[model samples]
Target: MRFSATALLALPLLAAAAESPYEQYKAKFQSFLSNFGVAGPAADKASAPATPSISTGKAKKKVTEPKPIHTLTLDNWKDTLYAPVKAEATQPEEWLVLVSGRNKTCYSHCLRIEAAFNESATKFAAMPQSPSLGYVNCDDQPVLCNSWSAGTGNLWIFEMLPAPAPVDIHYKRLNLTTVTSQDIVDAYTGRPDIQWRKFEGYFHPIDGFFAKYGLSVPLGYFFWALGAIPSWAMMLVVSFMTRTMMNRRMGDANRQGNAGGGAAPRAAPPGDGRS
Candidate 1:
């Protein structure tokens, strides 16, 4: 086909218009801009600056802190209980303390008491006013027990106050020998001048072990026997194995000696015997 230079240039532009969407749009936009007497690039730049910026001014929420729970210990006993009572001489807040033996020795009862008192304390603390609840180790703090008329491995209630003297403490023993967590809560919340009966004889060692775990006497003995059986069986098996190994070694030694003795003695030298 024959074509002029201008026509060939027009052919490339037509091909671009057909193949590229951007070029086609630009050509149409430039036509509209020429009709309106506006430059395409400058108009786009001027329109960009006309868009408005937005501000929300959103703020983050603040979190509230929780209240702390208090439990009595040897270190804090003086500061939380004794010091307060001593400082406030005539009028002092009521304090509940459970005195028991060393944790290792009386862990079961001590743990039960502690858990109960902790629950009671949490409940009481929610009220308008609540007395302090605490635990004391009799072994660690024998003097405190004596001063408060508390015996080791037993729960004691005391009313403490600051007097003209060093301290004024009154003991209030409960009537019941065995007390639960609820019992303590009731006693603390209820009457202070309640009558108390003397505790009977202490429990026997075996009886106490079973009682502490809330097991019947027969059941406790059965479990004890059950625990002992495995140890006894293991000891018997070890003894039998040792005896068997020893007997096997002795038999082997005897067999070797007998075999050596039964063998014929070496013959005398042939030349010496002939002479």
Candidate 2:
């Protein structure tokens, strides 16, 4: 009779446990806390599962930064910048590079941000995995700047890939306002919070007519210009050429008449009968 009564009483407790799983979890969590010297009931601690050592992540030892800052000019950009980064790697490597586009005429805009940009570059250069920092002055190296799609007062971030892989441009942001070092670091490590605007000619198709033929089709354009000339314009050219020829012939005749004195006797021949 005693055993039956005990079993009937325990049934309600088991039912409560099954009905509230969250309550059981809470007790287990409390017990886990108790393992860390947190006070809890002995029975609860005894029922808690053994805890295992967990590691969030390993910390990497930071090394000294390299000479990240460089000037990308027309003369050395191909050999210095492009060739080295594009070299094949035993294990694939990706390089993060940041480029600033500025002009001497951009004093009002670029000058203000220039100080902050330099400060950020100094900070970024100290990072263990520092990014390549470079700048292109449009006026100084217009061709190189154009190839990089760099416009004045703009910043570009690109991921340089190995050979055969095209460079990946991540963002192009106009630097109207100066930013802090933390802001720059966050932007370099991850993406910036603000919306990004594209560089000039973003909407232009790269493989356009002029881009395809370039200098090779220069004379070709002249031929096309000739074909496109209006009929009235062609008539004007022809009229001008004919008038020039007529003037030259008349001039030659005048000169010949003066030199030979043949024009003086023509009037006497005509008036011979009347005289």
Candidate 3:
């Protein structure tokens, strides 16, 4: 009876000892603190404000603005300015040349002018045929400088007729003491003499064909296939005719040989009897 009572009492103690490690550790810590005369809030009763988890996601890309086109020199003049104009320039078309010096005052002023022109480049591109803008460095190109007579700190506007023979380039000095981007654009577009050439004749059969169908963007491969069909058909027809002719000739030769040749001779029997 005494052993049974002791076992029942030890059963509850063993069950308490089998509790979670966190609960047991907390209980022991609390007991240790109590033994040292230190008081703290109960583990279950105490509440703490949670610290938010910081999430590190992908970094965004940096956006940068486009750099403006600066002053044009003789080396880059043809590629940057003149070539584009030449490719598009029809008869009676012209280019607008902006001439300036490379000195401290003129260079800064020219850059300001160039920046203004660059901003309006999109607007110019929209036109059917717009005058190309170019900068002439007077110090570098003395011949062009003398030809245009581009004075230092002066901005001149010119109409260039890019003709094959006797290249005619005309200039009319602008009366602007203070130049702006809009001023250059206005002067070029507003000029009454700037003539836009019209498409005179059909350059190719395909061009005419597409035009007849009112198709702006032609399917080039479709046209190429269409063009190849006739040649391919001709080649096939020629090959078939040649093959038929050869087969007819072979048949005729066989028929002729059969008609002309006689049966096998009985000479072999006679020769064997003679031997």
Better of 1 and 2 by lDDT: 2
- The order of the candidates by TM-score, greatest first, is 2, 1, 3
Q: What is the lDDT of residue 173 in candidate 1?
A: 46
The local distance difference test score of each candidate is: 0.55, 0.58, 0.53
Candidate 3 regions exceeding 4 Å error are 1-90, 104-111, 140-143, 152-163, 175-177, 192-275
Clashing pairs in 1: 89-162
lDDT of 3: 0.53
- Cα TM-score per model: 0.37, 0.43, 0.35
Error of 3 at 148 (Å): 4.0
| lDDT per residue as tens, model 2, 1-275 | 25787798899999887879987787889989988998665567678888988886987777644345567675675344455463565432333334443444354566655565667776776767766666666656555544444456655654555644544455555446755556656766765565554333332112224434453134334544564678899999999999999999999999987899754555544555665
The digit string of per-residue lDDT tens for model 1 on 1-275 reads 88899998798789877879977787899989989888677545656766576768876765433223334443465466655465545655666666665553354456555555556665665557656666777556543443333554444443455533333233344333465667666766665445433322222211233334544344534543454467779799889999999999999999999989988999976575554
> Where's the lowest-lDDT run of ten residues in candidate 2?
199-208
